[model samples]
Target chain A: MTAVRPPEADLVVADTAVQPSAPPVPPAATAVRPRARPRPAAPRRILMKGNEAMAEAAIRAGCDAYFGYPITPQAELLEWMARRMPEEGRAFVQAESELGAINMAYGAAAAGARVLVSSSSPGISLMAEAMSYMAGAEVPVVLINVMRGGPGLGSIGPSQADYFQAVKGHGHGDYRTPVLAPSSINEAVELVADAFELAERYRTPVMILVDGILGQAMEPVSASFRMPERRGAEWVLGGADGRPPRVVKSLHLKPEALEQHNLDLQAKFGRIEAREVRWAGERLDDADLVIVAYGTSARVARTAVARAREAGLAVGLFRPITLWPFPTAALADLAARVRGFLVVELSAGQMVEDVRLAVSGRRPVTFRGRMGGMVPTPGEVVDAIRELDGLAAGGSR
Target chain B: MERSVIFAGFGGQGILFAGKVLARAAMDEGLEVFWIPSYGPEMRGGTASSTVIIGDGPIGSPIVDQADAAVVLNPPSHAKYASHVAPGGLLVVNETLVLEPTGRTDITELRIPCTRLARDAGDDSLVSVVALGALVGRLRLVRVESARQAIRDTVGMKRPQVLAADLAAFASGYRVGSRTHGPSPDQEIVRTRVHHRVGVPR
Candidate 1:
C-alpha cells in the first residue's frame, strides 16, 4: 500500500491490524450451503421508485426476514415491506431503533436465515457496534444504507459522505466489509440481490450504499430474482439440532486468538478483493481525461461527458460498482492511458483519496464535489472537466 | 429526442400524480422515463413540483437544470418555473390560477383554464388531468391514446368515476392543445447525447 494520509490524522488504528496467526481458508471451501436458483417471474415493466423497488427486490430474493426503522428517503421501503412481508409469509419488524433493528438482523443471520436490515446515515452510526460484532462473528447479513447528508443530524437530502464510513471499516477491529454502490434504480435492484449472494459466499456482512436521490426517484424496472436460501446452514445455530451446538461470538480473550481471527478475516477479504471487483468503463479507448465516480454521481458524470464530447473534449467515466475493492486496477490502467483524472462526488473529497492512491503518482488526479445535502449538477461537472483539460494541456506543453 | 418537463403546483394539486401518469404513458409508448419529485419540507402543505424526463433512449440525469417544457398549475409555480423553460421551448399555463402572462416572447405559451374546465367537467380534482391533456395535445410527445390507457391503468381501477371525469377533461384539453399550435421552434437547443444507456452501456 502507498504511504497515504488517513482521512483524519488522529484516527485510531486497531492494535491487531498487523498481526496474523491463522492460515487463509478459501471462501468456497467455507461455504457448504447450496442456494436455490431464482425462477423467472413476470411484471417485466413497472414504474417504481428506487426505495419501493429495493424492497420488492428483497422480497423476490426470498428474504426470510426484514428489520428496519423509518427514516426519510427510506421510509417507503419499510412501509412497502410492512405491507408485503406478511403477505409473502415472511417476517417484518419495525424495530424501536436502528440498534435494535441490526441486532435483530444478527440474531436471524446467526440462525441461518436470509436477513435484510436497512437505515440511513445517523441510524447506521447507531448500528456500528452491531456491525463490528457481525463482522467478527463472520455472519452473512445484507444491510442497505440509503445515505443522506451528515456529521450531526444532517439534512435529509442525497449525499455520499459515508464513503469512508462504509469502506474504511464502520466499526472497531481490523476488518473490511464489501461495499457496493449503484447508480440507477435497475442497478440498485440487481446489486441488492447480488449483495445477499456475496454475503453468503464470503460468510460476511455486505452493504449496498445508495444516495437519497436514488431512493426517492422513480424509473421503469423489470423485477425478477431467484431467492437465495439461508446460507451456512450446516453450521448455523438453529440448524445444529442434531449436531453439536454452534456458538457465534466475536470476543477473543487472548491476544494470539484474536490475532489469528484477524488474519483469517484478512485472508477472506483478500479473496473477495481478487474475485469480486466490479466496475464499468465508457469510451476509454482514446480519451485524454477520465472522471471517477460512483452511485448517483456517476449519472451526472455521464451527462457531463456527453456535453464535453459535444464541445470536442475527450472525456470518459469510470464508475465503481464495488466501492470496497475500489476498482483500483482498472483505475490504475486508465490513469496510465489518460492524461489526468477528476474525481466527482457528493462529499467534500472522501473517495478522491482512494482514487489518488490507486493512480499512485502515475497521473495527476483532481476532485470536485458537494456536501451537506447539496448536489453537483451536470453543468458543474462539465466545468470541472474543462478545468482538468486545461491543466492537462498546460502540463503537456 | 429527449423531452424534459417540470410540473409545479400547490401541495394538493396532484402535481406529482400527474407526473407519474405522464411517466407511465411514456413507458407504455416504449420510451425511457425518469420521474423525480422535489422531496423537501415544502411538500408539506406548500408548493410541490416534480421533474419527468421522456426519451427514445436511456436517460442520463433524473434532474435537469432547465426544462424543455414547464406546466405550471399555480401562480407561485409559474413565477418559480417560468424562467426555467428553455429558449424556444413550450410553457403551459393554468390561466384560472395564474392570470399573468409570461413576458418571454421567445417560446410558445399555451394558456388553459384547467381549474374551470375541471369544474365544468364535474370534478374539480381533474384539473391536473386537464393540464396533462393540454401538454400531450401540444407536444404529441406521447400518443394521446397511450396516455388514455395509462390513466386507466393508474387510477381507473380504483375510481371508475374519477377516471371517467379525467377522460372527459383530457378530451377538452386535447382539443384546446391541438388547435393552439405547437412550440415555436419545436425542439430544445441543448441536445442530450443518446449513445450511452442509463446504467448499461451499449
Candidate 2:
C-alpha cells in the first residue's frame, strides 16, 4: 500500500537477475534430504530413539513438509524425516544452514502446509531469527529443539539451559512461542504431535524442546497419532482468483500499528497461557518438598522422588510438560501446601527462576543444577531436596 | 521388576548394538525399556558404554549411575563400572580383554572369554553380543528366545551371515553362562512377575 517494497520483491528481483547459464538451482540446492524406501508395513510397537520417534510421530500426524539441518543429538530426526518424507509424498529439504531450514519452514507454513524443523542447541540459536519472523507473521510452524549444553557450540549432551531462550521469547519483541518438553520417548512422540496441533490452533510457532539425552536415548514407543485437520486455506498465499491479494508479512512499521500487532500477539499468548498449561504432579498430596523440573531433568527428578519416598522423606516432583506457559498456577497451588521447593535442572539454573516466579515468595525454592552437558543423578536431586527441606521456612533468597 | 544393565567397552565392540538387542528383547517381553548410548568422543574408538533399563512399569530414568548388572568387555570399562554395580548384581567380564580382577566382593562376577568365544562362533564382531548373552543367560533377565528374536529384529535381512554368526555367538555364551552359574535369585521374582502380568512363560 505504502511505497515500501515488500520482502518478496527482493526475491523476485534476485530471481530475474539470475542468468540462464545458472538455471535456477534446484529448490534444495544444498544436499537434498535422503529418501527412504517404503517398508512393508508399520510395526505395532517398535524400539525407537527419541529423535526418530518424534520424527515418525510428526509424519504420522500428517506433517506436510520437513526442513532441517544436521545437528547433534537430533541428527537422527532429520535423517528419519529425510528418508520417510519422500515416501509419504511430502516435501523434505536438508537446508544448507539452520537459518535456511527455519526459513524453508516459514515458507511452507505460509503456503498453508504443516511444517516441521528440528535442531540442537546452537542450531536452535541460529534459527531464532526466522522463528521471530515466523512468530511475527503468525505462521503455524512446529519446531523441535533437541537441546544440548551451550552458550556456544558446547557439548553434545543433554542440558536445559535454553529454558529462558525458549520461554522468555528468544526473538525480538514481546512474543512467546509455546514450548513443550517431553521427559520420555513416548511422551516425545505424543507431545510432538500435540505441538503441531497446538501451533495450528493458535497460529503461532510451537517448539518441542527436549534434552539431548532424550533425543539419543532408544526406548519403546507405540507412536500412535491422529492427523489433525488441515487448517483452512483462507490465509494461504496462492492464486488471487479475482479476490484481494493476501500478503503474508510481519512488517508493521508504523508505531501505532506495531503497538496493535503486539497487543494482538499478547492477547493470543494470554489465551494460550490460560488454556494450555500442562504439568504432572507426583506424590504432591502430602509432599514436604517438591522438586521442580522438566524434560530429562524431570525423569531424573521422578527417580529422585521415588528414592526420597523410599527413604520415608516426603519429596515429590512437579514436572511442567509445557515450558512456555510455565504451569505457574499449578506450582503456586502446590507451594501453598508443600514445605518448600527444590528446582533441579541440567543447566546451571534456567527453570529455577520460573519456579521461583511461580512460588512468588510463597515458599522456599532452592536451585540445584548440573551444566556443560553434565546430567544430574537422582542422588544429586535427592541431596538438593534434603537441602531444601533443611532450609528454614522462607521464600527463595 | 526393574533391571538396569550397563554395557561398556571400546568402540567397534558392538556395545550399543548389544544394548539395543537387550532393549528389544525386554520390550518384546512387554517390559518398558530404555537404552542410552554414550555419545561424542567417548564413542569414537574410545571407551564407549550404554545403559539399558528394563522394567515392568514405566521406566523413570534412562541414565543409570549404578547398574543392577554390568557387562565389561575391556579393562577400562571394568575399572570404570565395576564399583558402580549394586550389591548382588551380575558383573559379566570379558576375560580375553580384561585380565585383572574387579576386586569387588559385593556382586556376582562371571568372567567370560568373549573375544575367544566370538571368534570360535565365527566372528570377533560378536564380542558384545557374546557378553550380552552371558549377562542375560546368567541373570535370566530376558528369555533367550526373545533375545534371539531381538537379534533378528536388530540384525535384519541385509547381512544374513552376520545374523547367523551373532546367534551362534549368543548360543555359545549362553551355554558357558548356564554352565558357570545357576539361575540368579532375581530370576524367580522376574518369572513370577512376568507370568502374573503378561502370562508369558519363563
Candidate 3:
C-alpha cells in the first residue's frame, strides 16, 4: 500500500472549487442504448463489472474524496478509486483500517466535500461507531456495502444477511440511514448518484446495499450521467473567516438537550419515511400471490414469477428498491387484494420480518430463505411458489 | 431466447477470462448478459469457474443450475460439471487434460485437445481461449465476428503479439470443433468397453 498524508492535511476544497464555472452537463440516460441505430451522437453502452461501474458513477456524480479499506468482494471498488481518483485530482486514501477509513470520510464530509466509503460485512461492522457519530453530527456521507456471508469470517459469497443490520440501524443510536438496494448493475449505477443526493439532502449517512453477486457480475451500463450542481454549504467547517467560529459535533451531555436532539432526529426520519419510499411491482393487478424480495433474491424471484405466469399461475413480484422505508403502505394495499406473499432472501430470515410487518396478518406471509451464502435457484423458488399457490387454492391461507 | 454456459478449470487456467470474453461478445451483439465467477478461497492451482448467461430479454439469476453448454478444462471440472448440462445441450471437454470419457449419452459432448491446440497455436497459456472457440464454433450462440471484436476490445491495442496468438488459437479450435460430427470413434470405443464391463447396452 502507498503511504499518504493524514486526512486533515489532505483536505481539498469542495468539488465546486475545482469544477468549471458552468460546465455543459448532459441529461441523465440510464437505459443502455441499442447498437442497431449506430447513431454517432448517441451515448455508448460499455460492459462493466458492478463494482467498477459504481466507482465510476460516484466519480461522475462529483465525489470529491474517497477513503476505504480493501475487503473481499468490494476490494475492486477501492482499487478502482485508487487509480481513478488521482487522475481526477481527488483525494483517495487506503486507510489503515475500517475505523480509520470511516473517520477519514467523516473528516472529508465535515469539510463539505462529497465523500464515499465502501466495504463488505465485517468492515462495515468496524465502522458502525463512527457512522453513529456522523449521523449524530449530521454529516452527509455515502457508503456502499457489498454484502457477503457472515456472522464471523464467513465465506466470500453473495448474501442478504445484512438486511436487518443495514435498514434497522447498525450503530447504537436512534438514527436511520437511507438504504437503497439495487437489483442490477445499471440500477446500481443510477443509485450511486441518488445516494449522494439523499445523504446531502437529509444531512445524514446513506447506504447502497448490494451483494457479492452484483459486485462481481458484469453487465452493460450507460456511460453518461447528469452532473450535479455543487454548492457551498453554510455549516461546513471551513475557517469561519470574518464570523464567529462554527463547531460540528454530536455530543450533548445535558439530559434535556440530548432528548430534544433525539426528538428532532426522529422528526427528520419521519419526514424521510413519508417522502423516500421506493419500490417496483409487476403483474399485481390480478394476482393472488406476490413474491417480495430485494437485491439478488429479487432478481431470481423475477424469473420465478415469469415461469409461474407461463404455467397459468397468477403470481406477481414486488421488489423494494429502498429497504429502509420498507414500502409498507404499498404492501399493505396489496395485502388487501393478494392472498399471500412469498419472501425470498439469501439469509435464513431477515427481510421477511419487515414483509410480515407490512402485511400485518391481513395476508399469509410465508418465507423461503437460504443461509450461509447459498442462493435459491429459480427452479427452487418456483417450486415454493407452486406449493403456496396450491395451498391458497385449497383455501388454506 | 436465453442460454447459459459454465467455464471451469484450475485457477491459473484463465477460466474467468474465458467467460468474460463470451459475455462481452454477447453484450456487443445487443443481448443481455451476466457473468459471475466463483470467487472463493480457491486460488492458484485450485478450482476456478465462471458462469455466463445470455438472453434477448432481462436476465434473471446470475447463478445457473443447468446450463445450455459447459467447457471443462480439467478432469476435476469434468467430474463436477459434466452432468450439469441440460439434455440436448453441448459439453466441450479438454481431452488433453481430461482423459476419461463422460459416459452420459444425453448431451452432445465435443472432446477437443484444447491444451495441445493451444501449444500448437504458439502459446500453451491460450487453453481457455481454445476452449472458448470450440464452444462458440459448435453452439453459434454468439456470432464469430462479435467474439473476435470482443477479443480485440478486451485484450487491448497495446499488445499486438499476444492478440495474434490468441486469434490463431481460437481459429484452430474453431476449425477442429466445426469439423467434428459427434462423439469421436475413440470415445465410442471407450464407451462400448465401459458398458460391456458393466453389462449394459450401448
TM-score of each: 0.88, 0.88, 0.90
**Backbone clashes, each candidate:** 2, 1, 0
DockQ of 1: 0.22
- Model 2 C-alpha lDDT per residue in residues A248-296, reported as the tens digit of each score: 8899889999999999999999999898888876667677788888888
Write one digit per residue (lDDT tens) for candidate 3, span B2-34: 689999998878799899899988887767789
lDDT of 1 by residue, B1-202 (tens): 3578999988887799889999998876656688999887784558899999887654676658778889999999999999999998889888889988899988888887778777766677677888888898888877788888888887875677577777777777776666576532321210111101111111
Considering DockQ, which of the candidate structures 1 and 2 is the better prediction for this target? 1
Q: Global lDDT for candidate 3?
A: 0.83
lDDT of 2 by residue, B55-148 (tens): 7655776667778899999999999999989988889989889999787878888877788778777788789988887787777777888889
| Top TM-score model | 3
lDDT of 1: 0.80
Misplaced by over 4 Å in model 1 are: A1-43, A229-232, B182-202
DockQ of each: 0.22, 0.20, 0.28
* Candidates' C-alpha lDDT: 0.80, 0.79, 0.83
Q: Which wins on DockQ, candidate 2 or candidate 3?
A: 3
Candidate 1 deviation (Cα RMSD) = 12.6
Give the per-residue lDDT of model 1 (tens digit) for A238-316: 7655678778999999999999999999999999999888887666666789999888898778778777877999888
For candidate 1 chain B, the 10 contiguous residues with the lowest summed lDDT are B190-199
* After superposition, candidate 3 runs with Cα above 4 Å error: A1-43, B184-202
